[model samples]
Target: DAGVTQSPTHLIKTRGQQVTLRCSPKSGHDTVSWYQQALGQGPQFIFQYYEEEERQRGNFPDRFSGHQFPNYSSELNVNALLLGDSALYLCASSLGLADNEQFFGPGTRLTVL
Candidate 1:
């Protein structure tokens, strides 16, 4: 079975642009979470999705949004990107909300120029 997967391993954009990143959760996993990691910094939780609904959110602006499909795949959309938005976007998958050992995909690196 395929583990968690993300598209466009790297991306570059200018301020004010919007970026959409994609993720497919690990097989049999239904919960998906997003995180942002800046240079030299640990990952910061962005939000989490389960049952096709957003269950929890992090300390991020409204520009960050996400969706979980029936198959457990997900997408992360960041609008009005700022230079500060440049970072590694990570996608994690688990069986449930209480599962602490989530499986993570290779992050998508976003660079705002």
Candidate 2:
């Protein structure tokens, strides 16, 4: 989408490894949300960050952490990644927390080996 883009379009990691994914939000957007989509399933909310703080999180565990910079860009870090972590990671940008209109990035394909 025009408002959101992710880096390293694809990645490969092994079990027990850690990875960091990056996302740059829309020029005027102030919030970023991360999601994970496994094959044959809908995207699952991972977490949301705004104003440089994490305001909401989904069912993911603590191993999943994130940081939002002042520029509105954000990073998602997953530690001790498991095979189940293999999925498409998506980044969505919005104006505010849970905004009605969210521009989502194409997603970063992560395949765990």
Candidate 3:
């Protein structure tokens, strides 16, 4: 089965611009978690979605927003992007909210120019 699929492998935007990224979960997984990985830093938890609701969120600013659909697909939107917002956006899928096994998708590189 497909693990996960992400759109726009690479994107470039200037400050104050908005960007939206999408991710599709693997088969049979209902929980989707979004993460941001910056240069030389480990992935940071951006947010998580289960059953179409945000179950948890990280210490990100209000400019970051996202949603999960009934089909377990998710989209993340960042408004007024900053240079610091440039990072690799990724998504992980799990069977349930508490599931330990998470399969991660490839990262989508975002560059703020």
RMSD of candidates 1 onward, in order: 0.6, 1.3, 0.6
Comparing 2 with 3 on TM-score, the higher-scoring candidate is: 3
List, residue by residue over 1-113, the lDDT tens digit for candidate 2.
35688988999999999999999998789999999999999999999999999999999999999999989999999999999999999999999985899989989999999
In order, candidate lDDTs are: 0.95, 0.94, 0.95
lDDT of 3 by residue, 32-112 (tens): 999999999999999999989999999998899999988999999999999999999999999999999989999799999
Better of 1 and 2 by lDDT: 1
Order of all candidates by lDDT, from best down to worst?
1, 3, 2
TM-score, cand. 2: 0.96
> What TM-score would you give candidate 3 relative to the actual structure?
0.98
Error of 1 at 58 (Å): 0.6
Clash pairs detected, candidate 1: none
Candidate 1 C-alpha RMSD relative to the actual structure: 0.6
Residue 80's lDDT in candidate 3 = 99
